[model samples]
Target: MQAFDLVSKNISQIIPIPIYVGVFVVLLFQVFPRIFIARQRSIGQSTANRPGKDSDTPNGIYDRKPSLSSLVTPDPTFSWRDNPQQIPREIKPGKYFLTMNVRKLDFNDYIIFDKRYLSEYRERQAIISNVGSARIFVAEANDAALDLCEETLMVTVDFLVTRYPSMFHRTERGVLCVDAGEEYDLVTRPWVRHPLETMCLLSGDDCILMRCCNDGVLRVAAVGLVYSLDIDWTSFVGKDLASIHRDARIPFYESAIQKSVDRYFLKLQPDKPVARANWLTQIGPELRNEKFPDEYFRHVSTIPGNTITPETVVDDLYFRVERQAMRKLPSMRGVVFKFHLYATNIWDLELEEGVPRRFAEHIRGLPESVLRQKHCLEYVDCILKVMDLMAERQEKNTTNFHN
Candidate 1:
């Protein structure tokens, strides 16, 4: 035994302790990480493709998939003619008040997944895939916007899973199941993937999630918008409400409007969701890339006396209405502003009995400054001509009735 110990001691002396320790340390660093990474990848693959009990079976605890046929039909109908009765009493045509105009949003109106869902979802997914994290913004947990995103995502998911069970399934494993048997990890942290991304995955609405700052100004911290109209959300990030509306043609930041908006945000309760509508006229129906430089519109004016008629207006212009909703998240105490866009041909306004007249009256009542600010000066004549045609048609109908 002494001889064996003397041989081992001689070998140890030949190879220094520090060299042995360095070799072990190098192997530890190299081998463990590879093993850990391999294990993680394997686990991820299994989780993604793991087969569970069929979601189609009738189960008391699990919800069945929602019927697509029934879900596509929009409720309360989106008619400009019917808008007056639907609008709050305080909101009138000439004077626009955000808070007073808003009404309690029905659960069905909260997140609309219409027939355009598939197309819109595809476009949104493409944008997110192409842009990566550019569309997602995050602030520190201590920041006012911290919990806004996650909470909004949670509520949206819960609402869909509960109400439209056929469309969304909650797995026994606590995973969210959507179409094509796909599963999502809804509980992932913002650093891994913002909750807004998950929301985009679930619906077509363009979400602009905001939170009140220390300075008492609402700042847009996160956005998941694929069809933003004339606005780049990136520029608005971290900006206060007033700053965001500084260049807006509409008088959204007027003293009264600003105060009401502030108060609305402050007093908004989790139980109540408020919705308001904004309408605009655009030259095309393209959903994405609605944003163009102001100079581009200005340059359109330089073209010498471009002739436009009622027929041209009907053929060329589109009417866009954005249904916007503001809901306060109970857990985060932050606001989630969602926008659902709809567009129709300008001539389609005539289909509704009173909508054309109301629209014409509203357009004629706008001040010159506001018209120029909205860049409507160039096409105002065309819109007026179309309005005249509608008026003439209404007058003819009245005359025939009297005869």
Candidate 2:
């Protein structure tokens, strides 16, 4: 005991008691945890570096490669043209005033690829080439806009490959369209085009992305229109819902459904998708990239649109219907709107029971401002006359068949 006390007194003299105490605390509190952490890290590295092996492979484990996932059979594509029931029946136009005709939709039917692909593609390419991509593909330049654009492209590409696997298959580097003989790298786009533009070129539907801004108003962030039917794409980018309504010159939007539209978008859930139908009458049957839309839309610059009459309208009119869908993004306060266009001549309207009569009655009831807004005023009277006659013939045929 005397010897131990003598050694302790010597140590205390060499180093102050406080210094020894501080060294003890430093070792106890800081060094131990660090030592323990380093031990754990070493163990983790060894485990991770260990090669993965199959239960059956005791010897060949070091040389084994990772097993690939099982191949999946693609679901049968819906042949919308062959299946009349699958094809949406022409919407019987109803009411005169503007209204949100949106209804819930199944994701499987969000965008359609049907018989019209080639013609639509041809027209889209031509429009982009002739009018400049600015008119067809316009977008805002910002982080929010770009993120949404990229997300939209990813979502659409995944859908296309899954929905039409035979036509679009996944490659190591990208998605390949067997029909087009073109491969698109989803991760990389052409230097001249935006990601959304590349996606628009590949998709059958035109895409428009809208984001809810700091003001809590939803505004268009990006847009790619195959053909600008009623509204121009350039004017819509970065504009709020109200601005878009005004720009489209939609009649009674503010008084009728502006607030409702805003509320609908704000409350829209990612799971719930909605679609609406829109119609317009073109001067000719799906007029190709017009040689002179720069000069005239009415075909002859001298004639003017109002000169069209029932007798003159028979061969000169085309009915266009747009299947527009809007849905919310799961990760962002934004929505993706898409348009799928379908067109038929006036004569085809008579094929469906009561469609001719219903369409004509619907037209006659439309308010003048709404008619002008839709660009239907030019051929409204002409359509009414032709459809009335067609309706009579349909009625007469039904009567005779029953007898």
Candidate 3:
């Protein structure tokens, strides 16, 4: 059969042409339209639910908001200096005992302005205001120490002027002066030439100025020292704390004290001020070079009788306490260690209630190593004798009180 004729005959027999046409029309109108509509709805839902550019979508799969801290700026005026906390002001008799519990220090208790502030300020101003007297107290500043001296002096002046305006005044000539009956020009005065000299003018405390060099160690850059009990300012100016104490007959630089001192200086902050107290027996109250030379430690092995005798230890000896404080200057980026020398006669301890007994305990409890380190071993016998007499007196008083 012919191919075209054969296909035509089969189509005619299989189905009517109308049925095929109807099925095609139904699919085009109903099925195709439904599929198109369903696809459009699905797209509309997806668009409605999708997150926008400003949506709170988290970084990963969760949603998170920014922290409040990230949105706020810190207050610049709030610092450790704003509100300094209180420290124990009373000089407790047994506070420094060797066997006593280690006292905890608060960060705010570093700089203390106690009852002695006015008296000390008056004494300092008196020395600096007098031309002849000021020359004797202040050492000539070296080149290396000049910048530090100036910066330290400025900071001290600013602090005193701002904190105690009644005590310090600014003259019409732009000079900062201390009011001591007559105004003492701290800045332009002939005797008060340098910044360190100004510090001497403001406070009786001996200022040992230090700066951290490239080696990360603190060096005594300058000193405005009037009353150094033993150490010489000339010899101590250029040396690090460790090197300065290296020649001590006792192993101070090698001991734990050095480590503690270095760490304290390193971690000290501008706002926090810290003070420590150290007591030593001095021959007299003279501020000059009353002790032997720096090299005396290298030559002398034993403590001389004249240095620490029963009579000298009891009668002549002065109980010297260094109320030392270290503070960081924000502008200078250096530390200022101020030592206020407070001296009382050994016999005066008897008058202060409980001081004699507590002092005796402190001295007795000190280790042999410590005594040697402090160069107190040679005078240990004399010190013990004095302490024993005080103890006996204390016991006799206690017995009499009970009756």
Candidate 4:
């Protein structure tokens, strides 16, 4: 034992304690970061492998991106017009108020291509030309707008080609192959400088990219408005959630649901997308006009209980429903708010079973304050009377057919 101790003492003396300390310091500086980085990599891999929780999902953008390889092929025969999405059954009789009513969104259902595609795209181009891209789309100056734009385009084209292989393809470099015509490449166009505009022109859809600010509230980091988009794009740019919702004047959003929604946006996971729907009964089929933004929306502010009677309301009623979906852009650290609006003249759908009666009942159930916020309280009676008439005619037709 003394011999072993003597040998160890000799070795220690030969190395010198200060030299040992120097070598240890070198290793700490050089090796620890790499080890720490490796540990981080391992954690990320494990997190991706397992399901993501709000608390655990890494904020790194590159962790998970939607790619063609990951896409779920849509039903070959799915027709957006014929196969209208089922109106979510979240509204309850006598219990109607503002609600998120969001559901898990399948990637395949992210963008809806309908009979209105060509017309909508034409309208989008006109809007772009008239309003200019700056009016509709905005993004953070320092963030990965380029990457987000490109990645978004890639996923979008992948989805379109996969969903409607006959209409769109990756054969050339475009999203379209509608005819024996030139196929659009699966890439951005050289002529368009603005990435978001290119996305709007190609996809012809409405989407806004939002990121949480330092204050912990989501704000409009980007926009790509081409359709009859929901948000008044110019109004909410750079505005936080509280201010945006307040400006939006959505009933109960500020008081009842702001915190919940703020947390929802803060914690939204990249892999999991959610969806919701909003319905409005308006006096006209024209829900929006891009050239005169928000003009149509505000015109219907007060119908005056006296101005809207059953006779006047029946001819002018239209129902507009916007199917909305929200998903996190992992790469951009943003949440995308997407909407597809479907408007049908109530005169056309009044006969559809349960359409008028259900909507009327839901509207009637709204508290007076809610109705006032909705701009319909003064005219609620007229609206209900028209609804009853439609419901009666529908029931009578059914009874006649049965008899």
The numbered model that scores best in lDDT is 2
- Tens digits of per-residue lDDT for model 3, 1-403: 5999999899888989998889999999999999999998887677556664563221121111232123233332333233432222234443233321123334333323445555566655554465344343343355445655655665555455454455556676434443344454443534335656556656545788787777788887777766553334467666887787675544434554777778778776555556666666556554332542212332443655435334443465666677677766543346888876666666766656666666666667676766665455566677667767877787789899999
lDDT of residue 279 for candidate 1 = 62
What ordering of candidates by lDDT runs from best to worst?
A: 2, 4, 1, 3
Give the least accurate 10-residue stretch of model 2, judged by summed lDDT: 63-72
Q: Considering only N, C-alpha and C atoms within 3 Å, which residue pairs clash in candidate 1?
A: 65-166, 66-166, 66-167
Give one digit per residue, the lDDT tens place, for model 2 in 1-403: 9999999899879998899889999999999989999998887667546653532112222322221111122456655344342234445466676679788887666656766665566676676677677666777877777767766776666667777676678898668867667777754533346666667667867778899888888999988776655346666788888888887788899999999999998887555678887876665655332321212335553674567444565565667677788877654457898877666778887887898898887888788887776566766777788899899999999999999
What value does the lDDT take at residue 242 in candidate 1? 64
For residue 297, model 2's alpha carbon misses the true position, in angstroms, by: 9.4
TM-score of each: 0.67, 0.73, 0.60, 0.72
Per-model root-mean-square deviation over C-alphas: 19.8, 13.6, 19.6, 9.4
Tens digits of per-residue lDDT, candidate 4, 24-131, equal 998899899899999999988875565434422233544665553466675666554554435443455667667666778887767766666666666766777876
lDDT of 1 by residue, 214-333 (tens): 776677777777676434456767766667667564554565477676777767765567888866666667665452223345555467895643345446676667778887665434
The deviation in Å at residue 140 for candidate 1 is 6.8
Give the Cα error of residue 176 in candidate 4, in Å.
3.1
Residue 241 error for model 3, in Å? Answer: 1.8
lDDT of 3 at 251: 43
TM-score, ranked from best to worst? 2, 4, 1, 3
Clashes of each: 3, 0, 3, 6
